[model samples]
Target chain A: MSKNLVEFNNISKFFGSVIALKDVTMHIKKGQIMCLLGDNGAGKSTLIKTLSGVHKPTRGEIIVEGKKTIFDSPRDALDLGIATVYQDLALVSLMSVTRNFFMGREPMKGFGPFKTFDVEKANNIASERMGQIGIDVRDPSQAVGTMSGGERQCLAISRAIYFGAKVLILDEPTSALGVHQASVVLKYIVKAATSGLGVILITHNVHHAYPVGNSFTILNRGKSMGTFEKKDLSREKLLGMMAGGEELDKLEVELKEIDRTLKN
Target chain B: MSVKSKSIQNKSKDERLRKVSRLKVLLNRPELGALGGSILVFIFFGIVAGDTGMFSAYGTINFLEVSANLGIIAVAAALLMIGGEFDLSVGSMIGFAGICIAIPAIYWGWPLWCSILFAFSMAVLVGYTNGILVVRTGLPSFIVTLAMLFILRGATLALTRLITGRTQVPGLRVLIENDPIAWIFSADAFKGLFSWLGSLGIIALRQDGTPLATGVPASVLWWIGMTIFATWLLMKTRYGNWIFASGGDKLGARNVGVPVGRVKISLFIGTAVAATIYACVQVLDAGSADTMRGFLKELEAIVAAVVGGCLLTGGYGSAIGAAFGALIFGTVSMGIYYTDVDTDWFKVFLGGMMLIAVIFNNYIRRRVTENK
Candidate 1:
């Protein structure tokens, strides 16, 4: 009975004869973690582009909160409370942490036609937001580029949460992270979900998602493999499906045969 | 239960604050140290000029006035640079705007305000053209604005000759002497206002009933006020953030739903408007507009921004720094005048200083960011 915050109803996308996404129907519930798994060229990027309003689907509609809406630009999607965090978060490396967090919506003080930057409030708010996300980053005045990759990702996520994003779309957030670092990012994803925001996690790593995801959608060559509830699928099945089980098995057998002949 | 929860929450908040302070320490790690060349120049100027009356209030005011003119242009130029573009035509635009005012005020007999308005509109139009061509056609701003620079310079020369029959456009005496507009363009407003306020000082209020007045030059006051405003815009406003983002990562800014095109256009307009404002002041002070005035001054403005700590690639600069950079240039120029040093040798010093500062800035960035 939970209403969908956003839904792609049979959307298709194509570049020349190559289909990027084919009749993909998927929905993100208001308060749940939805993971999209795929290898390279599995149309995951295409799907994200469509959802984040980077591109309009070649066919079908995007339904949001029981009403279908057409998003012409990313701002339109953002207005609907959908924030997309890319692999490389858009942050000025040299700018202070508070500046990066409040990039588009900075607070100003003072009266009349001449207003001043509310430095105290901005610094305080940035610090508070970072604390909420369990990032004990020292002064909000610190430069963003000084933070590690994982920490920057956390900052980006926290920024979205602070900006009142109803739905959070993460693009390969953990791809560049080490095991421990990825675990840190995964914790934040869970935290975001628990805070009552719909999280759409885009990643190729099934292991990273297995523990956190409530539902899964696998894509292959621009088409949806299926959408599965976490209880309905096993870890092995998901991996096998992603690696193309039969083909990987045949390749493994052939490699073994060659090794045995060489030994003989 | 409520009391316990509240105490626990307070404890957690305190813990969080401690952790955040630690992170702040990590982030404040210096990317670059203080600029060496700027310091050296200041020392050289001080040592050479300080021996005489060069360090006097009159000399200081003269230097500050020069800086004010340059700083005003440099601030907007820095904004454009931070937005990832450059305008080489700003200097020529200054000449053109002055000519616009001169022609209307003298020949057409228009009111001073009307002429000033016309000049400003012309500058805005030129800025719009630069923005449109650069953004719409996807041309490199360097090339487009460079072309604009030459075009405007040539046009200014030809027009001045055609209208005035000389290289200089004449007839701004009326505004300078009588018009109220002169107060804004030439008079030492900053000094006057501050003297008035300083005279009313409660701290200086003595039983003797004599209030001391502090004379702050109009140019210095203007520069300081503008610096404050520019700092606020860059640090606090949404538009200011857009400028930084667009300059830092134009594609990234666009990806994040920033109106990159609009931001660039506005900055272009701002730069031109600043030029026009400076032009009006310069013409009022001189009572004539020279076609060759401000030749290569655009480069100086850019140099000021770069020396002030703006990354040449875009993003990362402070308006205060740019103003400081202008101060360095202004002082060097006037300092040379006060000293026995020939003005011709000044260019060599300026060039060497610029080169050294760039190297130092780069080294600092590398040192701070490498480990991080």
Candidate 2:
């Protein structure tokens, strides 16, 4: 069997009286893309938050490389090579690209008590990393606010990859992007997955997900509709299951009845 | 191969970024506005007060002494503001800290250095307390530091009155002269250089062959040194990045594992310590501590920071800019005397210049970020 980098073993999370996630079980192998398909409130965020250590699972344990592990904060997850590029992008716009690239993890030079941030080294690494992803950073000292949304997304993803992320989770990376920009980000996803890092790509766009996803996991109203391999499920079937085909059918009939009543 | 990064194919400018003009890049600098403003002020003063000897070595040093006093606090203000907090108590800290040193050195008969050390420690405690209150209670630092300002001012007045039965502690010049470390705060530097210049006839000399201007004041050196250190701290260190991040976006920075609270606390301490340094220089030079000293200097320091191009909202600013802002202030306040303008108009000029600086900064930010 291929080595599983991380396994979400029957994780469930509840927010007081609300069941945000229920009995979700999935595993990500090294070098595979696990696309998470869900609607607006389908617990995709909650599930990823659990994996990224923003929230702990109310029930069940997480196994990483065959050992049960727990995470208290996002930093803990980062320490174990789990990095999440949140939907909001978590960047300080006023800061420079190099500073944002190494916000938490800055490279230091000098010995003992006289250590300093290595600006030359940081600028080189940041620009190089972004270049690998096709972002020609003219100046690493330019403020992040000046960059396009797509470039910012690429910066975040590339930063995670550069810092040695074993598992990269991107929450709705392409939702706010334009057509060309979306394609740019999609390439980064494929690029990341092919680079041997296990990726959990969260998106509602079936078209964006189907092209790059190795397998798909569908979430509906806090319940999992099972994970499916690309070959086992056709693109049409995957979209149908992701949008909960039966629920859509029921809504269509109900809407038609309302239309007839209004006409009468 | 999947584990490795792919090579870049596109060697052109990023298509997503609009072709920004060189002018736009120049406008993007935080210090540009302040630097421009400082130049304009200097030119205006040069034209109006040229024959008044305002630009001469002696007159220049006089205004510089005033500028240095405020620049020290303003540079520290810029840092704290960048770290996303305010220290309104900075002005009151000067008065309180001086008294703290003066009471012990003169009244209790302690060593001057020991008293100076005591004052700095107290400043640390005050700064740390302010930081703790702001972070732990999640209150606005403006309000917390404002209360601190009043409390410190009132305490300084009350304590000075109770201890010595007077508002001023005077006549400590002999003691200061005797003290080993007082020269760091009180004495002028570069005396030999000035004497050499006098001998070379490059500068005006007195009957004893001493230059009209003896040397650079210790305060000026402190101002320049502190500003340089602050600029370096902001631009070249991990802590500098964290300060920008912490002020830029609290949650975003915290999510990325930046210790926002600790960074802000250290910044608060910086301002307090800067205030203590200001107090030491003044008290040592004057050979006295007065309760009325440093009144309303907080507003002046903020004005300097704001004029220097630090955003009132935090996250964006420069220490060099703040230093220039103080330069403009000192020049205008002192230059008015040489130009036959009432010193009262200094406040008017200060307000008008602050308004202009703020407008310029806002316009530049809008123009640059318009691409977004």
Q: Judging by lDDT against the true structure, name the best candidate.
A: 2
Model 2: per-residue Cα lDDT over B86-185, one tens digit each: 8899999999999998999889999998999999999999999999999999999999999999999999999999999999998667788678888899
Relative to the unseen true structure, what is the C-alpha lDDT of residue A29 in candidate 2, on a scale of 0 to 100? 93
lDDT (10s digit) by residue, model 1, range A44-145: 998998999999999989988888899999889999999999877887786778877877677778787666567667777887788777776654666777
* Distance from true location, Cα of A160 in model 1, Å: 1.1
| Chain A TM-score values, per prediction | 0.94, 0.95
With a 3 Å backbone cut-off (N, CA, C), the pairs that clash in candidate 2 are A195-B2
Lowest summed lDDT window (length 10), candidate 2 chain B: B1-10
Clashing pairs in 1: A138-B20, A138-B23, A138-B24, A139-B24, B31-B364, B190-B218
Q: What overall lDDT goes with each candidate model?
A: 0.80, 0.89
In angstroms, the error of model 1 at A233 is: 2.2
